[model samples]
Target: MIRVAVVGAGLVASHYAAGLQRLKRAEIEPYGVPLAKFKVIKDYVEEEVVSAYDVDANKVGKPLSEVVKRQLEGVVPVPPDVPDFEVREGVLASSGAGLDKMFPVRGRDQKLPLKEAVEEIAKEFKSDNVNVVLNLISTEPAEPFGDEGKLAKALERGEVSAGQAYAFAAYLAAKDSGKPVAFINLIPTPLANDPAFVKLYEDANSLVLGDDGATGATPLTADLLEHLAERNRKVRYIVQFNIGGNTDFLALTIPERNLMKEKTKSSVVEDILGYDAPHYIKPTGYVEAIGDRKFVAMDIEWITFNGLVDELIVNMRINDSPALAGLAVDLVRLAAALLEKGVKGTFYDVNAFFMKNPGPKEARNKARIKAYYDMISALRELGVIVE
Candidate 1:
């Protein structure tokens, strides 16, 4: 069984936890509940509530048991046999990763030193046999700008970040554990892109990949549009506008960070269309207190030589985290399989199908999914298993 440690225990983190639990047969342990279910306090009442943590006075020092009760608020409770995990304090300075207005405000607690945090994570891995770390934190638009080496050294030296020490601190800690670590980023952050970070993982003989997990309508829309374009269909322009009250949406409200997300999302579509398809992809708005739902509106324009133009408009709303959280569960198992088989950085197929921003763009639609299956099959033929 691959013991995977989830970095953040927020709303999305909860979904990731649930998704993993759903895959229990596949060996994914719950880090907590899914963010959506967390809101449905009544639903978790009888469900198994694993580990949960946040920096909030209301919840800061609360025990795992209390946290579970508080989370239940008005929801139904499950059987008493359902176990609960501890709610640690100062795991983060702020849920600023995205927990601003959507979820309850986190309390201000003394932050953990980066060194101590790393040591805690490393110790957990060493003792628990955690093989990979999945970052289901908020959508941190700001990516690492080539400073993972500094971050890695800080972990070794016990350096901690209270007010935004480099974001890759968690990645470095996982690497330092000396256990083969495979990191899957579901948010649009750049930890996996920096050369230094990549090298650190490579040097450690571990694996790291993913800048974003392409969940929900984004991937569904992108792949579908690509299908039309590949068929020699004329794609004049594409515009995708999205809005949600989820933490991911709440996090991108920062103007600077929003721009980064816009550019990254736009580029994914741009790259898929090859320079031929003009397009705009942006997170249009943030609706607070709606819990965890994402609404997407997409418009596609195509022209035919007959001098006529055709347009396609589509709307989709997804339960933000669950749509992609399911994939994250698969990724942990996939990562373990790769490590057990001695695969190196960026396993292409899993990254392509499961990530928003893969290392490279390949053919869209069935071809892309097919390619991924082939890659995993090849690896399996090599007899890789999670050690």
Candidate 2:
């Protein structure tokens, strides 16, 4: 079985728990899950959320089932069979300032030293036999630790971001247990992109996939840019923005946190188009009344034949958290299967399609359509995708 652990108990985590249970019960079709149709080495039914962690005081001690009901109350039906494991206290480190603005914060590090808290969490992972750990926390301001020595120094000074702390915990879990674990970072911390963490995971025979989950306007904009690129269209400028009511969007109201997201979102232009286009792309605001469904607006102007200018304006309303939750479902299964195939470190084939910034610090974002086919081909060659 592919045992899983979630690092955040937010809306995305709630949707993942509820939707996964429903999918396992066959109460719902796997509509949003991208890889549901293909037969992978690991099946969806074999995946179980065995543990969860969060730094929010209100969520730390509550059962995941109750948390799901509270977050998704009228939005989605919470399966009665959702796991009842308590959401354990997670690490906070330097990332808690913005989170404190949203909710009362409490973390294991507050009660103990950062290293000890990481060790405590790692013990839980070992005890729970977790094969995949999902970092679904809020966007935190973090810089890549290019060297393992620098990462170790930062951990010593408790200067690492929460995502980095948890990733280290997962690494420790794998090292101590002699069983590989996969840490899929869905938030905007730089674990997968950081060479230090990638090398650390490799040493433990574990895997790290992420930087940021691309589940909305970012991917769509990428494909559109590719469409223009393939046609040799010269792009003048691009403007895209999202406004949402989710806690994540609220968290993005903090300039540093919002900047973290912008860095990931804006990378698509230069990476996919092969030239840095003038673009303004990022989450702009949080309107509580709008709830989790986010408003996305995009305006692109490109030079057409004979230097004629063409413009495309598109607007969409997307369910933010649930979109990432769908991708999480595929990621959890893929992570476990990849580990079984002895794939350690960050896998670019998987990240290019699912993550906004991909990984390894140098990996360029690809158009989702091209990324999808390329990833499928890579997986099939690895025997991870049998169908």
- The CA-based lDDT of model 1 is what? 0.56
lDDT agreement with native, every candidate: 0.56, 0.93
Q: 206, model 1: CA deviation in Å? A: 1.2
Q: Could you say which candidate leads in TM-score?
A: 2
Per-residue accuracy of model 1 over 91-185 as CA lDDT, tens digit each:
44322544545455553223555456545544554555556666655554453535555755654554433222223433445556666766666
What TM-score do all the candidates reach, one by one? 0.75, 0.99
Which pairs clash in the backbone of model 2? none
Count of steric clashes across candidates, in order: 18, 0
Report RMSD for candidate 2. 0.7
Give me the runs in candidate 2 sitting further than 4 Å from their true place.
none
lDDT of 2 by residue, 1-387 (tens): 889999999999999999999999899999899999999988888989999999889999999999999998888788899999788889898888878778999998888989889888899999999999999988899999899999989898999999999999999999999999999999989889999999999999999999899999999999999999999999999999899998999999999999999998999999888999999998999999999989999999999999999999999999989899999999999999899899999999999999999998888899999999999999999999999
Q: Model 1, residue 21: displacement in angstroms?
A: 3.7
Candidate 1 minimal-lDDT segment of 10 residues: 37-46
